[model samples]
Target: MGDVTTIRRDVLTLPVADVGPDNPLPPLCPPDEIHRPDERDGEGLPRDMARQIGYGRLRSLLPERLRDGYGRSRAPRAVDTLVIENDRLRATVLPGYGGRVVSLVHKPGDRELLYRNPVFQPADFALNGAWFSGGIEWNTGATGHSTLACAPVHAARVTAPDGGDMLRLWEWERLRDLPFQVDLWLPDGSDFLYAGVRVRNPHERAVPLYWWSNTAVPEDRRVLAPADEAWHFGPERRLRRVPVPVHGGTDRTYPRRSEYPADHFYELPDGRRRWMAAVDADGRGLVQTSTDVLRGRKLFVWGTGSGGRRWQQWLTEPGTEGYCEIQAGLARTQLEHVRLEGESEVAWLEAYGPLTADAGTVHGTDWAAACSDVEERLERRLPRAGFEEAYKAWRTAADTEPGELLATGSGWGALEVLRAGHSLPGTPFDESALGDAQAPWQDLLRSGSLPEPRRAGPPGETLVAPHWRDLLETAPAHPHTEYHLGVAQWHAGDRAQAVRSWERALGLAPSQWPLLRCLAVADLEAGHRERAADRYTDAFDDLCRERRDDGEAWTAATAALGREAVAALLAVGRTAPARSVWERLRPATRRRGRFRLIEAELLLAEGDRDAARAVFDAGFEVADLREGAEAVGALWSRITDEPLPERYDFRMRPSGGGGA
Candidate 1:
């Protein structure tokens, strides 16, 4: 162990000038507009999933009339910020700005490792439209501008177990009703700092959860991770697996902007190799490692010399060079639901710092060889006691049977794999010999290794029955058995049977939204508009009831489903039912100061000019309502033959306008 005397803390501030609010109110999207949340349907995204996945829709709907521009307000200047350093490394955390790690420097070389933003500026880039770039952005709760991301958190400095300094930042996630805390511990002599995160759910009901740490490094650096294959998302939204480290005859681990921006995923198969790095050619850079809890690695960069990349630079700062994100996620990717049981808490530790290549002969541009160099350096730089013990523990955990780990409560975040309704291989036993099939089939279902349905062809009823029939015959009580049976039934084009299976699954898991959503979709596709609307509403109500304090979640759901449900009713010319949905969602929408334009449009469609004007006045900005204003104006002109209200000024028309 090294001496504890070397740990120190200092305060420095990076001067910030407020850019004004978002300027020129953005337009309102039609209530029924379909926006795909992810490459897929976002079937079961966990809480705290990254904001980029469909959460941005919430912000796009709420128009920001005026935006603050960072360029004109102030010049770059040094200001007070928080710093914690040991003998080997220095790390700075901005307490005033969402507790982001604004800087991390290697003490030996006096080199800055993190991509530090030159100006403290924010743009409407996040889901809820307020995010600053660079550094490490800790995301928690269900995506978007997490209530905690931009808000000030509770910060404190305390002594670590080894008598070193530790900085603790914590916040209560108001939206999900969870409390999350992080401790940044810089030991006296270690080259790396440990970031320990803890999230606790106080409620008795299990809730879906998500957590990710996004670290920004210079774009010139190469990234490396231990993985055999990578997932390639095609243009048509299919995932293809290719060998990692090298893909398409190129080394993908190296950072270079692409012609088109894309996100690449590498699965950390087991605990032993759950680490990634951003390094230069000489094998010198930062390495990030985490416990099995954070098993996903992502490499993302804005395409080189693209308009979007240029715009990003301009939004963050002028002369801002490009940077790539090396992200560590709690799961393989965002949006997959990970259940956090009631009153349970999950914790994990992540560490990253500088690596100095030594002893190893430099090999030709091989990522594996580079990783070996870093590993050797890590073994030498980390104290024997800490490094040896952690390595042993990780190896032991990694070596454990994957199924045994699940049984022992070790793979809590990976429960998504256990979701029922997956398809399975057909048994050799004859279909008439149902009694002989049950015992063997139940074991397969219990193993959670059933293959997912192939989307290549239309659902085949004959193919769907054999696998699930055996399980249902053998284990009728298993909800997952019913769930999988339902999915198979749906695929086979047996809608009635599929609904029956889903109903059974719901009986077993009442709050499970996927089952409800699947049923609703089936209803909608079958032209049962009223039934579909009711089912959608029920699922929406269940979601809101579970997360009552989360208005953003409510807003997201309203935009994604509630509005669609209402539109489905309207599409079928069912005005009374549509009005009911509008009324039920009015409180939350009004609280967010949105959707009044849609409400007005609905009213105008019904020829209720007086009521439409009332809602329009409540929701529209007198100066920036634009097309919504004109639509309302035209309707009132036709109905009442009156001049526009004085508040409505159409003198300076924008290039275009449209109906709400």
Candidate 2:
């Protein structure tokens, strides 16, 4: 309530005080304001402040003692560790903790500076060099430590102005142990960090506490979250809360660089959970957080706006200094019994750091983890007996239908059986076996007739029925089946037959995704560049509409087909068309190393070596996809007509080549 500027500076020095009789006092300084001195020289200004003050300020604050300390402790022992498991994404967790993560490093390599551990000096609490009166308190009580007491869990000493070191502390508590279990990973290679913290009340007495993860963002960082309503509590308790829908859109937080003073809280309606992001202005990097549980949680974002007043305004600014505080339960006592009990027993918290600047790079990792999480949750909610029974029924139906089709000697009868199999409601097609089905279908297309019945059909029908008659009588002759049949022919070396089958498939299901995809591949293999480009374009368009809801198959298909489409478009001298396709697909495709090689090809065609090299650099980061990268390198060598690195190899290699 004193001068707002002074309050922002003094907030961290003050002892934990109760905001109410029951709740622990909210910390004074915002969580992000805590400093780390070892990384920086003097007063450990939060990352945002350091940026505003300029690196020159950082250089001037270079404390001699800290410099000497860093020189000696550059390879300090692992203070904390988190090991990502096979089930969890290795990429997300490795980059998230920055340098503090000693056990796991991302596949390509880690980002510099962002990932290093920070050091702290006590005087960092004050804007000036004077030592502050605060110290981190590690406390636990029989009633469980108050959420407010959870602050000061992590602290750092960073360089300050005037050649001194300042202490910066992060106030958030670790819900899980360091090196805890990672439950899942997105196909894109990002990880999901999950930890459960238990809060216990040994005295058997009810306790009231307000809990919020003091998630801090650098000063110039942006914090975005899903919201149904937002409220501001400041200016002598003048509270203003408004209703809104929960969604992603334009900047809703402080949008301008100047409006800094603001403190606000948002309430999510029941059954809603939100994903929040802390991003820099240019969108180059971001730190994202979310609560996995669907129970409604409160969001609190407070920070000094561009106006230089910390926690003042309610409006959002696109680029500004601020941080987001996320709260769950209004007060410790108010949290639902389940949440309290969960917290008492074990509370789960996860954090994924900034994915690379290219959105596509992170998409796979994000989606994989997301899908796994949803699947697990769904399974947990389903009745075990009913679920098991349903699963078994679907599998049996799929298997039996295939068997029945082979037993029908007449080709039309077999087609009818297969169609019925495909149409069975709720059949869980073994997607993993899809590749297996390709060979038989291809062989049939090549032979143009069944050479022998694997199993004899009903006694009256001949196995070699008229093709046209069979097509007319078969179950709708859907495009998907025809496409697979084409793939079978292609694999059998009957290119002409393969093309015909694919064309037939397209005729039945003009917009069927799988059919269109096969057509595109057929066109490519046949050296029909323009046709391939057109097919690829159409298939990609269809995929875009369904990407969000579909599972891994859709994701992988979309990315793979989209990349090929881009390459085909480029190959046909449709540079402009290629560019458009590239633009649309780049965000999702560029993350994997193979896409980079394709991108490099497109760039090289444009005579932009610089851009092509940049793409290559990105590809090299991926450990598994290096074959594509090497192929591209070989292409580059061909362009120069000179053998370069030993890694270059031109012949196409199998896909899915990279490893962590």
Candidate 3:
């Protein structure tokens, strides 16, 4: 490593807005639609009955990427690549390609240290639908490839505090309506590229969000991270956590030898170290290190010869080329749930550099071996101060608050933290990431003193301050801000403007059920019965997209939508669809008992008291429902004007309500 302390920046030509039709970029193709077995089998029935009815079903059919050519080629073909180079390394940034670090070259050998995909291929692969793999991708906002992946960001070359060249990339994430930035600094004489990241929720309400820095490398490398166990989706898509590298006494780490395609997420055993590496067959590769804020380390390998590899290659290119990812995240894996507090920002730093170790020394499951390799490559053992120094550097550079540095662990330790009611860093942000502030007014209109706009307004007579428009103007792409604007416009007697705002919001965050539901309510108020029914149906479908394991959200959706949905289906003589709703809502009771009440109510409404009693008994077997059953029984008694028999402990009561 050189000792000079200067920095330099080289800016390339600016990227063009759109590629010409004659360009060699791959033709855009729509992703294959997701079709469940039942849906596929329903094809023989009448058109209405042939379609599966659910929020998830409807959402799965909605087009993810826009069909127009302009939307398909939204990302520019030519990028204004920025180069931050020093004597030891050169890092290139593609500001147009999601501000990705497209290349990290080891200056000595003039060889690429990170995987550089030969072609710039964007496909419908990310959660928001478009994604491109390779180099270091800043995945912020939610899981998958992030909204910015393959999209342009605001980038500039700046001077670091240490007088080094820094490349800063940032953009507003429209889905979550938040601002985030990544600053890359490579000192004149250093081998590593240091990255500082900040995600801010300017509003008083906090939102859920996920972030990760995904670095891709050639598949011939072996990953060495501090982990004793690995979690992956096993048979039947069930998550199974087993010993790392070897599951069921079978080596499962490398791609060349695996029988089937496997996605392995290792639980980082040492959060204090905050580092992981991928060493190639030549004993040379890259080392990724970060502050405690970026504690999670993940390794993903697509089998050398498998269906998964073919599927991925089909999107990138048809070839034998394979790659693996070494990701640094704020949680155990990138998919874990995380929340950002209102008016708070999360800041962290990470580094990537070339590393060389003795051949055959890398071991994926052994933490000691991995640390030894890092020590050998760096020529220094990381002492306690090493960790503290990194933390101090991140804190000082980002001007972060001490209280905001969450004291958490990695891997299972993070899982334990989540189980304890505290948010883990880098987890997937969900709709509930808004903390407790679900109301759009609290997020957009409230000035900390004003009353929230009521839904049952004097029929669209609620007042909105002029500043609220300014907020919307500043965050034009924010779905929540747009939603609030729509409500305010409706109240101010601007129904057309309200619909336009809502339509825009829906386009940005199609799965946000509240937005869909609100739109439906507005339609109903305007006597647009067909539009209202369609919006309500879309809202219900959107709610189904929530992971079933999220019991609170799942149950809440079922409780809010189930009764009306079931009644409507039954009223139309759609018993099968009504039964399906009950079955779909059944899993909600496994973790929480709220949905059990809905099931009981549905049964009782159908004049099946015996079945309702049976449902309650079964619900108790699945979850602890003492409190829920008591509440449900009380509601039932009031609604039916019937007093319950004494000594009836719903938790321990006999099935069929003691042979009532």
Candidate 4:
């Protein structure tokens, strides 16, 4: 080897919008799913696609809390990064932030192959919330961005096939309860950066699997994939088959041509090489190609319209460049999930590098010729046989034990290993990784009961998996056990049992809000608005008293609970008490942008449109305002709308219509 590949520890200092503490409350199953299995599936569906259209049917987000507590305010912070480089290419991986490959540089031309964000700004884009845009993201567990989008992953140096170092990232994805790992290495003198991903379903029963490697490239490029047609899901939220490149009057292959945001999943043929690329006017750009196991290719464009443009600006500093996502997934589309067999794993390899094709050919009006040119270039660069050999080599080296622990992720993986004795050879979840969060659950495993209340902050997060539920059920009956057991039961769809367990827990304890909040949610769902408000009011008051002297963790908890309580009271037409709860909030907490919006809503409920408009006029950005949420626009329309102010227009879909 002329130039030895290197893996080193590094830091990237940037203005990072803090991803604040997670909400302490649990989110139950929605009354109905956005897509139902019984509904006639989208036309030309693939096998098992219909079944997976509703993979989240009857789903609950219990163990994972919503992370909507981030803001636009950012300060310089040193984010830890792992750098793996060869003479030709340099790859920077953020192991602390979901193992996201934050940057890839092609050294020959000194070109950045990815659109690296200038700032680490958190927004309401992830499944559990607080997601930042840029780089190559590992999307797993569901249709939306992974719960691990901003969370860490276990990382360590492992042996490469050529005996050099490789960075391996592994984590237990809680939403689907599976362990997955990604191995990244660069061969000596190779320009391509290779990533090998493995997702293991350790359960005895089969489970749905979702994996997508999302790569972001500059928006001002022509994207090409090996297909003549695509499954287009637009802001209108309807799926239809359309011609590649040009649809309607413009060519969407260039991301900015469209007026609204959309996803175009390329309809690759039965045996086409799996790849996606974005080539610039000079026909030089990044190309991401994966092994056959990773079959899907897609392009997500945030159109050049106001909302889309605003969203692009929102994810980074104002002057930073914009980007579009060229993604590869296990299924034909992100809307579908593949069925993974029990105790089995799916593994694939992906290569990302610079692609320089003929500018005229790639930018030509003939879509077929453009795609063929890129595909032929890709074949010349990385032959299918060579790619297959590399995959096989990676498979053989996958089992090599990690040499050094570089970074540690969540303790849930180790907790799972201790609970079920999962023998994941390549990716080890060492017991040392277990920390404070997992301590109570580990004690439950060891001593058959939870540890005493660790001071009256918000209740330690609850686990609602079936196995954890069984343990909770067997633990001696007490307020703590009953409270957690209720959460478990609720997750299992046993509504009556869950309510009774919570009631018993409240009976055993003196007005704990954790238990009360769950009961309040149940009441709200059951059309008991007044009763829900009553419970919510009591819960807010109790939490205020309990977390009086606690710090920011409790501060986050109080803010979350207070918001919920106010919303419940307002829904029940009890503005007086809602105002009371709002007043009781910490001044700083009430001043948050989210709370400002809530205050505006409350003022509007009190028939004070001028006050509500003033709240809007004073100019506050709900930093974590949800994607596609009409909350801001709806309030603007109600408060004497002047065309829904362009500054606050974050709408992705068409306005003035029913939307999901």
Return the top candidate by lDDT. Answer: 4
lDDT string, candidate 1, 1-660, tens digits = 243523234556454555432322122221221212335534443334433344322212221112222222345555445677776777887665567888888877998888887776555444334467788878776532343444455555544545445666655453344566666777567778778777777566776676778898887777777766765442223345567666777766655635434456686565454677787666577778776778778786565533335434544564777788888887666434367888787777788888656323322455567666666666566643564455344332221211100001111111111323212111011222233213334345576333322321111111133434454535544555565566655654566987888888787664455566668777887788778777776766665555344443334444445556566666667677667667767474543322555576578667787887776455453211221124445544554555555433231122213211
TM-score-wise, the better of 3 and 4 is: 4
Each prediction's TM-score against the native? Answer: 0.54, 0.28, 0.55, 0.97
Return the lDDT, model 3, position 77.
Answer: 42
Provide the overall lDDT of each model, using Cα atoms, as 2-decimal numbers: 0.54, 0.34, 0.55, 0.86
Taking all chains together, the TM-score of candidate 4 against the true structure is 0.97
Q: Evaluate residue 507 in candidate 4 and report its C-alpha lDDT on the 0 to 100 scale.
A: 73
- TM-score of candidate 2 relative to the true fold: 0.28
Error of 4 at 307 (Å): 0.7
Record all residue pairs in model 3 with backbone atoms less than 3 Å apart, i.e. clashing.
Answer: 55-541, 207-433, 208-433, 209-429, 330-425, 336-427, 336-428, 337-427, 338-427
lDDT for residue 456 in candidate 2, whole number 0-100: 18
Tens digit per residue, CA lDDT, model 4, 1-660: 356899999999999988988877777654222222224444556646655675654367668888877888889999999999989999999998899999999998999999999999998888878899999999998777888989989999999988888999999999888999999999888889999999998989988888889999999999999998898886556667789878897898999798889999888898889899999999999999989999889999999888898899988877888899999998777888788999999999999999999999999887788888998999999898899999999999888889899999999999999999999999899999999889999999999997667556677788988999999999988898898899889989899999999999887675489888999999987899899999999999888777766477788888888999999999978999999999988898888888999999999999998999999899888887777666777778777836777778887877633211
Output the worst ten-in-a-row residue range by lDDT, candidate 2: 62-71
- Candidate number of the best TM-score: 4
- Model 1 misplaced regions, further than 4 Å: 1-80, 144-147, 233-239, 358-365, 383-660
What candidate 3 gets wrong by more than 4 Å, as runs, is: 1-77, 234-236, 259-261, 270-272, 363-371, 375-391, 399-660
Tens digits of per-residue lDDT, candidate 3, 1-660, equal: 354433333444422223111111111222232211233334443243222122111111111222111111224344456677777787887776677888899889887888887656444455444466689998875545664666666555454646544566655564455567677776556678878888877555666667788999887777776677765632122345678666766666555555444456666655346777777777788888777777677776655433345444533455636777888887565445366788788887787888887765664446467657775565453343554565465445453211211111112212222222333233222232232223443443334332333431111111232344445555445665566566656544566887788788777663466666667666665676666556555566666764345443344444445544564555445555566666765453323344555566667666788777776556432121221124554545634545543323232122323211
Give me the runs in candidate 4 sitting further than 4 Å from their true place: 30-47, 56-58, 656-660
TM-score of 1: 0.54
lDDT of 1 at 32: 22
